[model samples]
Target: MTTPRIVSLVPSLTEAVAHSLPGALVGATDWCTHPASLDVERIGGTKNPKVERIVALAPDLVVANEEENREPDLDALRAAGLDVLVTEVRTLPQAVAELDRVLTACGLTTRPRWLDEAEAAWDAVPAPERRRTAVVPIWRRPWMVLGRDTFAGDLLSRLGYDHVHAGHPERYPRVPLDELRAAAPDVVVLPDEPYRFSAEDGPDAFPGLPCAPVSGRHLTWYGPSLAEAPAVLTTALRAALD
Candidate 1:
């Protein structure tokens, strides 16, 4: 079978597909910003993709993630007779496996070299000895935190930061600022996406606590970025701890 033309709604997946097959991606959501110069038709945001524009592009497949995209949008694309490939990756292993699945399903007979490098990168990681307790907030106003079964939480755990709310029932639950600060975690891990938490904005929330500002992509994204996540995230975590 010929390689399917894809429209990606997930930014990480967009980069993966674009990096692997280059021109295979013909359309992507506005949020798919990797490859810096990716030349694809814009189909709006992940949650609010332009179904008509996607259909107009006549792509063979539209890619999305279960957590980052809405079911109604996937249903809409499927209803339009466009094949939609949805992936569910909440862990590093799942990320690697799903990338292989998506690539193979898209017609690549072999896995990409970056996939190997990404796997090797994580495989080389040894468990950090000085594990610290941390509160990782993804959003501020109303304050949602990384809870159970999250990619970011797993990454933190591997990097030796125990998430204070890892047992919360919701994957991301809103905790009042007072409650979060009162938790008295060793550090506050702030990612620069979802809410773009920065040194000035997020660290101020917890005056005395160390705030480790890191890239949201390295923490959450599971594509090409995964190759460098271990080193990049470790540096930030260590810097904050120091």
Candidate 2:
């Protein structure tokens, strides 16, 4: 079985999938910084993939996602007759599908037993009993939040938590703190990235509501890593609900 010489064109799954596929990855975008120890070659970012630089790496397959990456690069890569595996993940199921596709494209089907363990963990994660959650994704000017139709919201819905702004049609909506108060989230989860929600940030408008820091990667990036996120998220959700 020959492993394909792979290059990851997206940053979100770069570091993680690189480690999972073993020798399949030959290059990745400059932002692929997860397995921090591996010295994979750099291609570029979502907008600027440095096509010339990527071509130089001579990858047998290039993996990319639809979120942050642009379409033109995909077109150019396809036009050049490169073997590209593009995955568009919008939901948790889609995230799992993306990982499965990557592994299939890399020509490795027999995944480690840990993958089953991870899937079991997700399956075992008790569904949220009563919908209740105040998921605050960011801490910044205008105060952004995950709303209906966003990946975070989809996950929140799965956990049985009533996402504070899931009613809004927009994805990440910038609203006044007052608006959040009106929504009144029972559990306010501040994620660790993009906005870096912190306990030191102090009590928000809510007095008795449970406020805690959460993992941005688990909530945001749905992939191989997410297989383990159920335990973490379940623990957090239980803590918040309890």
Q: TM-scores, in order shown?
A: 0.97, 0.85
User: Which tens-of-lDDT digit does each residue in 10-114 have in candidate 2?
Assistant: 655675566567677788877666667767777777778988777777888888877667889888888877888888776766766677777777776677554
Among residues 3 or more apart in sequence or in different chains, the pairs in candidate 1 whose N, CA or C atoms overlap within 3 Å are: none
Off by over 4 Å in 2: 202-209, 240-242
Model 2 TM-score is 0.85
Worst lDDT run of 10 residues, candidate 2, spans 200-209
Identify the candidate with maximal TM-score: 1
Q: Please, what are the lDDT tens digits per residue for candidate 1 over residues 85-114? A: 899988888888899989887778888999
